[model samples]
Target: MKILDKYLLKTFLITFTTVFVILFFIFILQTVWLFISELAGKDLDLILVIKFLLFSMPRIIPLVLPLSVLLASIMTFGNLAENYEFAAMKSSGISLQRAMRILIIFICVLSLVAFWFANSVIPYAEYKFINFRKNIAQAKPAMAIAEGQFSDVGFYNIKVNKKSGENGNILTGVTIHEKPNNYGENKTVIKAKDGKLISSEKSSILKLELNNGYYYQDVTPKKYEDRSKLPFVKSAFKKHVINIDLSELNKVDTDQESVASTNGMLNVSELRYTLDSLNKNIDNEILSFSENINQRVGITRTMRAVKPEQKKKPLPNNLLSLFKKNKEKLELIKTASSNITSTIYSIDTTQKDLKEKQRDINKHYLALYEKFVIAFACFLMFFIGAPLGAIIRKGGLGLPIVFAVLIFITFHFINTFGKRLSQEGGMTPFMGAWMSSFILSPLAILLTYRATNDNGLINFDAITTPIYNLFQKISKRFLPSQNPQ
Candidate 1:
């Protein structure tokens, strides 16, 4: 029994890891290809690009690892079923639940690792990646160009034919090929007679000045004779400054109101702050609305009672009439004053509302923190995989791969949809992210039971047949009444 268990576990681990690597590479390559064109003229070093991609890996791994586990498990189990290994195990008195007990333990450990990766490692990697890019953007001007190299300046590809040191900066004969504009196929090439590079550490600006340069405008010629000569462009001094905002380039903010490191990752403190601010704002708006309503009512009453003629009357006479006729107005003024006091009270209540909201948000964060159980999904894959193997009774890649893909697709879709909704404040982040796996736990158990008992996969055909028939009947009933023939 021990030998058999070791063999199955080994096979599962090998296949799972191989497939996961393949999928990871494919995703990484796709991302790199999509962004390569944008980096064409930019002085992005190969080493830096590689480092950036490496740093980004931690962020994506947490997302992909679970699916990889699902796929690997399904395939592994499907293979076991095909080979009758599960049947043999059953014959030897090893229950499906007993076999899966080991996997459950494994899952628990993996879950903890995933939790740490998401809440700590990934966020730190993201922070460093952003800062590195910002530093690259603000690096020295001379470092921007390499001799006999084609470098990108924003959207333009520039090459320098010759270089010499002049006035604390590099001087060169420059060739710039600007990328296509909205109106043209491609930009005209510019050959500068001479150019100078300037850099300042205090300001994130690289200055390039060119002298005695002629330009050719690339546009569709309207007349036949107009195409006779290229547009004569002469410039005495052409200076360009590439302004880079180092601060905006990086997403992390290090300031008084900036999120602290303890609250930096998907942690409780930041969420609490956001929730508290929103609740306070809502309370303030509610109070302001009440104040506005009272003010409006008071002004309306005052307007109705007071007249132009009354205002022009003798002061005593006006005062007497005001007393007689404007008693309602006076009462409204008093009521409004009371409402204003209530508004003040509401302002005081805002702190309490904020605290309550902070507490609620912290509850969610704490819930996620405590229930780090979801991290074990990697190991849970084995339970789903091993039993699925016995049930399918298929071995090689074909059937296992298909089953794995179907299960993974479903899981991925659920997880992603939930994450997006949660991030947009529609759902609790912890619940949204883990809901799919939580729901699937029962299904895995059921599948394992059926497989262990030698019962076949559920008869979906019979279940669907009735539903399809009902749908057909409903459609027929709803159809527009045909002419009685």
Candidate 2:
């Protein structure tokens, strides 16, 4: 690399790293705030918390990277411009376009890296983070039942007056209150002298066994609606078991819906597969309906020719009754055919709805694909940034950074709006995600040319100001009247 190119890269790298660290720290702080609830009253080590944060970092890194790059470029070029190093470079034989080639190359590399991280690393991190949370939640019940505090686990609200550090295996002075499920069944509340949490050696059951307990239960199930008091029975027991299913502790994968089957989430391939499956189901349903209709038509024809006169031949009473039963059978078949037709229509409507849902899933993957593609903006920024710096006769972090940030923010906002439109099914997937980039490409080229020729930054703020003013005036005119109405 030439001296100029090497110098530009060094400035870019330094700025990028500094911004990345700050952003990463901010993300970590946000996470700590979010998960503080889960970490309460537990002897959770720092290593475990750090591991969770690290696992989460990749998932959010894609979002942060683009902004970081934008900031780095803006600051790097802005400083260079402020220092007038760009002027010195221009005074030499180094042209603006020549100087930008190195920056462009650097951006290309960054874009590729961003793409890899977003598509692969981020998805895997999301999966792990979800599982980690589930594992923690599974252990929450034990952690929740602290000494001298009321704890609610599942359906039971219980309190323990005191607990010893002896393996945390036993509690004393236990009081329990249980509420019936939604089905109006009676609830049993138990008061015990002590309780212990135990697990079977070979099974996945978590058992809360209480000792020396008197259980109180309402026997009358129907008396919940009436205000009349119902008598309760008190039974003494030496031990009682509250068994819990451990399988409920597993992390729930949202994509494990029936439509998804085995595919973890609705990726591009999964969306396509689901669409095909819905189509096949619809076809099969139609074919089944057709066969049923044909059978009904055959039954109707067979019954039509069953002549009453021909049936005068001597026949056993059972046989004659059997012939008579054909009429009712035919009528039943006709009713069934009508019901099937109605059902077929309903299925058709349902299939259409499923197709719409599948389309929505497709829209999401399309957006994801497009967002990854926008990482190529890393490359584009270099094109715009490098040339602007050279033409403005600057090489420092000051002016280049400001210009880069403005360009990136404008493009970023446009990209976001387009994606939302796509997700809402307002715009075609390609158009919504890619159109902003396409529209800006030519504009970026123009800006690069002007900057290379020392024409200064192209200010489109005039055009935007008018649109903003128009919205402001419209809001002022209409917003106030609607409030009273």
Candidate 3:
């Protein structure tokens, strides 16, 4: 290895390490702030907290590492250019491309490492993080309930106006909505003036003792017309005690859902497998629906034993004439109308459901492609930053940081927008995943070519001189700058 390569690599690595650590810490703080509701007042031990942070840290690498590389590359190269080292190298017959050769090799290796990390480590961390979240409330049964907002613990949605006592066991004006199913329909509500929570870690039950409360259970009639009555069974109690199973709380589902969705929790291989099943599920559902619709319409059964082609003349405009009786004709019309309404409803419902399933398919494809996106992003950022630094010729934390931040923000915004659009079926998953890279890649190439040939970001003389001459001629033609000069 040449001395120049060694020095450049060392300088760049040092900057990269510093930037990575700082940015990672900043992002970690943001993570902690985001989940503060879960952590604060939970009486969680340090070890659990550390585990939570550790599990969350890996997921931030994709965001942090790219920004780190961009900033570090800019800073290192900018400093060298500012110090005239790059100029000296250029004078010594070392082109910008030659100077970047060692770093290019390093970036290639980093990109591969990034791909491996995204496929293996990030997915593992995501899986573990989801599990940790599911189990977090179990650490403290009381922790499951927040003071102001409704908290889902077990089958009940619990809210407390205020909680007092050392362990926040004493609740004032508590309201509980008990959901009998996972889809969040609540048939039972209990309100208490005061309550106390009693729990034991070893036991899977949390006991709630309430005072001066009312229990209201809504009842629905089987007849649709009677539904508006909204009959509910209500009872007042001087004191009541409810036992909630902690094990059931562990079964609680979130948007990511029981860790079952695994949208971001699967490696590329597993994603492909899951995606295949999802596609098959959608196809089978459509097929089954079609068969059901055909049967409902009675198309599969011949309406008449004789074929319609046997008719010598056209049927009467009054098709009901064949029925012979007005009552029979009216009944047939009513039945047909009802069937049409029902079929329309079925088609609309199925159409909406199919759209959601298609979105799910898009999400899986996005997840699969994201692993590769992270890898490519490393190369993208490096090419952009290295050449940009050479062009700007500014060093330290000032201009380089500004340039890196603006570029990274643009990349991040486009990436987020593309993913959202893709999820909504606005674009293909492949396009959404690579959109930011595609937009910025040409800039990378342009900057590299310019820097290699000792060209500035723009040929100001070529542009300004033409504009200046045009303005001078315009002035000479319109209003001569006079004899004042």
By lDDT, who's the top model here?
A: 3
Question: lDDT of each structure?
Answer: 0.62, 0.66, 0.88
When summed lDDT is taken over every stretch of 10 residues in candidate 2, the lowest stretch is 255-264
Error of 3 at 432 (Å): 1.3
- Using Cα atoms with residue i matched to residue i, what is each candidate's TM-score against the true structure? 0.55, 0.56, 0.83
lDDT of 3: 0.88
Collision count for each candidate, in order: 13, 19, 0
Estimate candidate 3's RMSD in Å.
Answer: 4.8
Model 2: runs farther than 4 Å from truth? 40-43, 142-244, 247-360, 367-371, 384-413, 458-485
TM-score for candidate 1: 0.55
In TM-score terms, which candidate is top?
3
Sort by lDDT, top down from the best? 3, 2, 1
The regions of model 1 sitting more than 4 angstroms off are 37-41, 140-376, 379-383, 423-431, 460-485
Compose the digit string of candidate 3's lDDT tens values, residues 1-485. Answer: 99999999999999999999999999999999988767877777898889889999999999998999999989999998999999899889998889989999999999999999999999888988977876776556777787788987777899999988877799999999988876745899999999999987677889999999999999977544355578999999989998987775644433233566677989999999999999999999998999889889976645445578876688689778789888999989888877786787678879999999999999999999999999999999999999989999998999999999999999999999999999999999889989999999999999989988878889899989999999999988999555763
Candidate 3: 10-residue stretch with minimal lDDT: 249-258
Which candidate model has the greater lDDT, 2 or 3?
3
Q: Candidate 2's C-alpha lDDT?
A: 0.66
